[model samples]
Target: MKTDSRWITTPITADLLRGALDLERTEHGVLPHRLPARARAQCGDPQLAMVESQPSGVRLVFRTRATAVELDTLPTKRLYVGAPARPDGVYDLLVDGTLAGQGSVSGGTVQVVDMSTGSMELRPGPVGTLRFTGLPGRDKTVEIWLPHNETTELAELRTDAPLTVAPDPGRKVWLHHGSSISHGSDAASPTAIWPALAAALAGVELVNLGLGGSALLDPFTARAVRDTPADLISLKLGINVVNADLMRLRAFGPAVHGFLDTVREGHPTTPLLVVSPILCPMHEDTPGPTAMDLSALGAGRITFVATGDPAERASGKLTLNVVRDELSRIVAQRAAEDPHLHYLDGRALYGEADAAELPLPDGLHPDAATHRRIGERFAELAFADDGAFAGSGGERRAGGR
Candidate 1:
């Protein structure tokens, strides 16, 4: 539906956005970026460029009395050449911190990628709008969470009534970094992602840096984490290293230590937690460079298989089990000097037993239900009375420079 001219139009400003590090003005409108321009410029990888702009944990937040709201966006939806059609990305609206409504815009830009060969083609489409109606017409907080996997360019925001920047609720800020799993892979919606859900449950503000296929302990990423402000920090490592086959055992340990050292430069006393990879049977004992299961692909399903031999471990190839053991030792050795530093086995969030009941649909990322389970488990483990993030008593700090 065309937006009513009488509806109030508001400028999409930085103050109204959360979880994004930078905002780039585009020909259409503003694009929220998880990585800063400097960090982005330093790397030439298209994967990082794409995922950082997906706005995994980013959202528009404010105080409004509008009963109806509309957001105009140009979303770049990804399509695999031979894979089944994927659903449109979801937009979740919250009123006073509770899920009130959901919407999705159709007819945006489409990016077709070939999995077998690393090639991409972009097809531009018209801008679409997401509309949410019947919100409570009283002074209340409103949050419109962008899609976790879609690259969205904000064009306009329309509301039946005026809105203002919402006041901070004095919650502690939690900054977390991880892989695609933490980035909301296969999760139902943006807010339903584990980090977002855990943050809501723990009553803390969140700045998620869960870049898909690009959390490989890069100096720029470590610098990004070093620069971002937060009361608590957590790093979920190992799976990406194992699956990407990015490095050997000798390089993995030093890379992790260096990454932590960079983060500590800015937040020396902040509660920092290091988490290992969860149970992934494919990569647990077997090494990888995981490959797409071509047999399943022909049947319109996407699945992955580890290609590296288990014997490669003797030659320094990294596996999930090897990564986990190394991470445990590294954290334990570092904790004696850094009291705020802590370690949690990632299996505690999603373990062997949980996998048997709810196996990974793609042999990798969890399904929607498992995302919820992980989020709930994370909240229980990280925010409990004696949890790693416990006793963080202070007003939430503002994130983003």
Candidate 2:
């Protein structure tokens, strides 16, 4: 804790947060969670537990006249045992809804995972501070977007001026769910993630439920989405399912239906969009159980390779193409009775041509440039005049310019 008398310390609370469904009071401070406690209690998956705590679209929003601000955070960074070190997660500061500055914290806890053996080891580290100074002193809305890929615990918030929770701008809330790509894998920062970028471009409040390696249409996740308040909803399905090889085609269809049913229970007429997987050559026609490219491991690079047999499609195996076909058919069939239900072929956002231009460096997640491209494309497609999310009363351009 800083002893500077000029700094005003404010206790972090739920009213200062956006995009997180729940907040867990930690030993140091509150930790934001994308999923509620009831949903977390149902699943014992370690992957879900970690990713949901990563605060994809979560941020601290308030109105203040502060010219200087400091946030104390304890971040848990993930590392693959033999792979190259991951970069430090970034914190983006926005003033009056426009990006103003960016900073990062250092010396936090580390979690090292051995991909081949599925083993994880933790290393303790100290908390770090992120500070921004010399802002315009006039009263303005300020947002501190946390890292999308790092599990962070908020310790304290201090500013040179008094701060109050910002009133809601009354934007329609968009609740989205998907895999790691949507969870912000390989993106530059929190606000640079595709969902965040798209929400900014489309002018809506984002509630990201994009769990990495865990968007397998789990009932608990569906229930969480069902309970959250939202005017628009989207599910980016299939990649995690195919890569995890969690189920067969027989189970995939029913799982998709069940997930939608759960969400519709609470939001029956909400414009719901079902998005199929984008083009990943490794899993496009080939079934997965994607594996680490062990050969690259020696070079300290991490890449993925599909291990499932292409012949397994005969046994009801699910592939990207298979999932896309199934999703289109399912959405069309359901749309007859539910006019608000919509389907988007994920390739529209990133097709083979785009993949050829900006290949997935990991054979899975998109690069930062690709993330920007996807976000821009998604906004155009989903928020356009004739798009499914259009005319939902919250489709303004970036900064409402």
Best by TM-score: 1
Q: Write the per-residue lDDT of candidate 2 for residues 1-401, one digit (tens) a residue.
A: 99999999999998999989899998889999999999899988898999999999999999999999999999999999878899899999999999999999999999999987899989999989999999999999999999999999999999999999898787888889999999999999999999999999998889899999999999999998888878899999999999999999999999999999999998898899999999999998899898889889868999999999999999999899999999999999899999899999999999999988999998999999999999999999999999999886644322210
Q: Which candidate leads in lDDT?
A: 2
TM per model?
0.98, 0.97
Q: Look at candidate 2 and tell me the lDDT of residue 267.
A: 84
Q: All models: lDDT?
A: 0.92, 0.92
What RMSD value applies to candidate 2? 2.7
Q: What TM value does model 1 have?
A: 0.98
Q: Which ten residues in a row have the lowest lDDT in candidate 1?
A: 392-401
> Please, what are the lDDT tens digits per residue for candidate 1 over residues 1-401?
35567799899999999899999999999999999999999999999999999999999999999999989999999998789989999999999889998889899999998887878999999999898989888999999999999999999999999999988766788999999999999999999999999999998888999998888998899998999988899999989888889999999999999999999999888999999988888999999898888788888899999999999999999999899999999999999999999999999999999999999999999999999999999999999999999996665567532
Off-target runs (Cα >4 Å) in candidate 2 are 393-401
Query: How many residue pairs of model 2 clash at the backbone?
Result: 0
